[model samples]
Target chain A: MSEQPTHHGDRPGSPPDGRPDGRPDSRAGGSSAEQPAVTASPSRPATSYRTLRLGAGPEWSSGQLALGAVSTGGAALFLVALYFAAGGFDLIWWLLVLVPVLTLSMAGSGMSLGFWALMLYGWFLLTDSGSFTWWSLPAAAGLLVSHAATALSASMPPAGQLASAAVHRWGRLIGIAFSAAAVVCCAAAAIHGRSLGLGPAAYVIGLVGLAAGVWLVRTNPPSQPH
Target chain B: MVSQRRRTTTERSLGDWHPTAAHARAVILASVCGVAAVLGRRPDLLVIAAPLAVAAGWGHLARPRAAVTGRAALGDATLREGGVTTLVVHADPPVRQADGVVTLASTAWVERKPASGIARLDDDGVAVLGLRSLRWGRHRVGTLSLTLTSAWGAFRVGPTDLPDLDICALPLPSAFDTSAPTPHPRGIVGQNRSSHPGSGTEFNTIRRFHPGDRLRRIHWPVSLRTGDLHVTSTFSDEDAHVFLLVDAYSDLGPREGIDGRPTSLDVTVRAAGAISEHFLRANDRLSLRTVGAADVAPIGVGSGNHHLRRVLDTLASIAPATERRDEGEHAIRGVDPMALCLVLSPLIEPTMVALAHTLASRGLTVIVVDTFPEHLVANPANVHESLAWRIRLLSRAAQVHSLTSRGVPVVPWRGPGSLDHVLRDIARRASAPRMSRR
Candidate 1:
């Protein structure tokens, strides 16, 4: 069963201390105790802003700071891999290191798609050897962390202080998502190293695997109410 | 006279859900890019698309199963100007990850704290907005709109508009009072002391004790000195009838709210409230009639606290310039012959002036209260408008002179003590003998 809605405690007309003497104020139509019946909104922490506070200062809590560090650090590590993958000659590859900072601040509304695609292209260009590399595994981990962080940051309001429980929950989800990418990376590396020359049969198996992955992604799960 | 139904608690059914651009972007980018990466023999592209694939999969898996509905209610329906009331908006089957916004559209004379009129829902899917009415009268509080974004801002339900809520804002009465009594006392119960002697507190004289005199009323000192029983006599308490005819034809001046100067209609309605409050508290019978607004509900003659509320409610229902079909006849119909008729008007309307003359012709004590705002003459913003008003007011001056010549007093509303001098004069005139025209 859903929890009963809590009273909005900070109503301006409500008494600051408590119900006023249990006697109705003729002007207010009822006592302070009866005010709860009138103003029954969900309870919120006193610090929560009433409106969406855009462009507000970053009042980072410990949980938010930790989450921010993990997300940006993962993105920065992925950029280092991309630097080596791009042969480390061009100065342009170094600019990719700042994707983490952009993800930290300018995350919302799928705006981080550009950064994600750029990192993927950096990995794609490293395929000049015409063979899969084991380094793709760590690169996958870094990209997954950055994506999860962007999603988390977008979900939160600008001035919102993160609750520890929410951060932990998102962290668990991110871990699970990265684990799936890691599993796929391991399978690809095994297939590439084995040099399986099964020809048309191998192509058939790969196609089947791709189909299954797409089906799993497309399939809807039975939704449960909160 | 504007008639409107009272608002009650209601809930809106869930609105149609639509896929947001954010959701589509994640799905399209993930699926198309993932398939192309495998075709191109690139595992790196697969990694990039994996998280987005998870996002798309999660959104579809966790979409809201049931329809999302919203309910809104006001804590109090009636409020004095500047008094605050709470509005609560709630969504059913709360989506833990969803972000909901509650918006109250901007309305004239209603001040919202945030000014933008938008508020964020708490985790439990409820939002609270405070509304303060700046002016008096029956006003529709702004329309409430609710929008909910669920599943990582992927799926959405409504920016659906809920039903309009209304509030009755009673005018804060202008400070007014009078020690002088009403012109004509007719009813048996009231605070006014009449000429005839009966049961009352104020002493008229001492007389020899009659057979009907109670022992409590006997004056022992007078009896002992005169060698006969004597009793104190007092004037009987009576009540007066006050008939208020409000003119709602024109609302002059800029429609500034309570913080600024009042308009002509504002002055009239507030003056009527102050007069009604003062007389009602004194236990006087009051009746209200509106000439220019026909939609306003009719109020009959009554006394006591409950009747006082009815009077204020009727006053709050006034909508200016609504009763063009109303002639002065319906307003004066069934009015008590002995009642002192108070015609509240700006004197710009000829119908109001004619109504006052008609009341006087019917042998009723009539008084015209000029409710034009002082700022109209003092602060004319433009030269053309000032010139126009000056000419119009000159014509209005002749109308006032006509009413004065017809034995009807024309007095401007000045809040406190505005009617004290006129009411005392009417009472004095009522005491003198006069011939009635046949």
Candidate 2:
């Protein structure tokens, strides 16, 4: 799901362990301590929805994806209103528009999580007053790329062929590219702003997309946990 | 304090993970609306989103821990030789949408979850995942990880530590060759075989005449002239020791049987169990050791329940090495001339066959329980692979015959059946050995 660099294959960083079982230790130099704590993952006869594993954990009373969207959208709206209220209609502000996709539209599965993208779209269409700008195109493009990178992350290889070197190399590149695109796009946005400072818009989108990207990698691509 | 038993622990997990997505959605929605109003200078909607988010998160904060538990029914630890037994794993977690799974520590049992969610005993839960028994021995039945979520993708994961059970599958002894003439002259009840040779069914050894020896005119003139007393040595008539050499080496074929039954090891273990139990009941001293570890791990030499347990434990602990080996490879081949030797193996390679011949040459009674049929014996697919597999099986079968011709009785049969039939068939076909009347 990488947008900018076009990183390839699933699991931006997962292909490394390359264990035939894709067990946590398939990672080289991994010790017994590093083995993902073994909690029973739903044994899917088929390889599809990488099962989400957590025993009802704690989070900010507000949901993560939702909270992030609200925080981000509200910040964007605030910045726009503050500018407008200050009688600054002529200000062409720089902003980032990233599609915070929790998962990509994978080839086989339909269970992919798109909460982040959905909320962001809603924020764009219904709640926010800020109009779209040509300057924001790259930011949105970068976000879409990040979504694709994540989709690649969840893109798993066949179960028996986990250790193939080709898979892991592509995975790492995808992860890095995903993060890099956001950073690089914002840099461009900041440099080429036709308005007042790429503003809070770029910063908010960059923060949410990057944060979600890290989380997606941390949870791992949607494959069976070893 | 006593930890009592559990009948169900399902209701606990679902109650815990029920709110995740909704809470997140509401918070984000409310925050968004609030931020919008603040941006647009409106506050009413933010209030509404906040309460809705709270309602969604209520169950997460309210639910208690240790809410889910399950009770599991166990299967045989020692499967009979040439037999199959389904390890019944019934988990009843006391919650709806409480997903559980079963796993084993033994690698021998190729674990498969063919059925997700079995509605009853027959259904395999590809839906919920089921664990299958692939090998014989003491196996631990432990908890499964379950994640419960709302339809909105709001979910929570928790542990459903189910009640655990241990399964012990014993190895199958090679079928007894009953017709090999029970070395005893009279095997019927009451005609006991004793070493003293006063009056018994078995003849141990002939020696110089002696006084106090049952003098039914025993060599009258020799007894009169020798003066010094001597007796013919003999032993108590009993079943000879038959140590079965199970070579859990390279498997017969792929792990799964043609009909999805189990591996040769699975059949071997079950057979071993039935044989051990049978010999125990017959009061025969039966010992166990693999053809691989025969030199060192000779077991069941002593008669009793203790001996049986020892063999069963060994079968459970023994990990079949995938590396190929032969009769001279290991220092563990247990050879005993006093007992009959039984080799229950698929003979995947010729080295194992050679090892059996070596054991038989050691003056021990030998028998081979042929499991080769489980592997290459048939043209399973009628494809090139199947044909090749068949050839490999045939060669192994030939090796069994070569050993048999050297005096070791070999029994060939199919699994999902009793191994005792091997013993009974051998007894029916083998002619009685010549005996001298005392």
Which candidate ranks first by lDDT, i.e. highest? 1
Q: In model 2, which regions exceed 4 Å deviation?
A: A1-226, B1-24, B35-53, B56-114, B117-131, B137-143, B146-237, B257-268, B293-296, B316-318, B321-336, B383-405, B414-438
Q: Tens digits of per-residue lDDT for model 2 on B1-438?
A: 011222222222222333233334433443454355335422222222333223223323433344433334432333322222233433334333222233322233424332211111112211123333334444453343333322122233332333444444333333332223322222322222433444444556656765566655355455566874445545555454556677767444555521245467755664665566555555666666664432235464665666666666666555555334545444225555655556777667566677767776776555677665444435456578767877666666677668767877666644323345545444544345757699
State the DockQ of every prediction. Answer: 0.13, 0.02
> Which prediction has the highest TM-score against the true structure?
1
TM-score (all chains, Cα) for each model:
0.76, 0.45
Docking class of 1: incorrect
**lDDT by residue (tens digit), candidate 1, A1-226:** 1222222233322311112242112333211231211322232222223322124544333334455677677777777766665555467766766665645555654446666666666666655434555566666677667666655554443333344445565666667767777777677766765755557777678678767766654523211111
DockQ top scorer: 1
lDDT (C-alpha) at residue B212 in model 2: 61
Residue pairs in candidate 1 whose N, alpha carbon or C atoms collide under 3 angstroms: B1-B293, B1-B295, B1-B296, B2-B295, B2-B296
lDDT of each: 0.69, 0.40
Q: How much of the real interface does each model capture, measured as fnat?
A: 0.11, 0.00
Candidate 2 colliding pairs, count: 74
Q: What would the per-residue lDDT of candidate 2 be over residues A1-226, giving only the tens digit for each residue?
A: 1111211122211121112342322211211221111212221222321222123421111112332343345334433433433334333332422223222222113322244334343334433343323323232332323333232222221111122342343344334433443453344345442454556786577556544533332321222222
Report lDDT (Cα) of residue B279, candidate 1: 85
For model 2, the DockQ equals 0.02
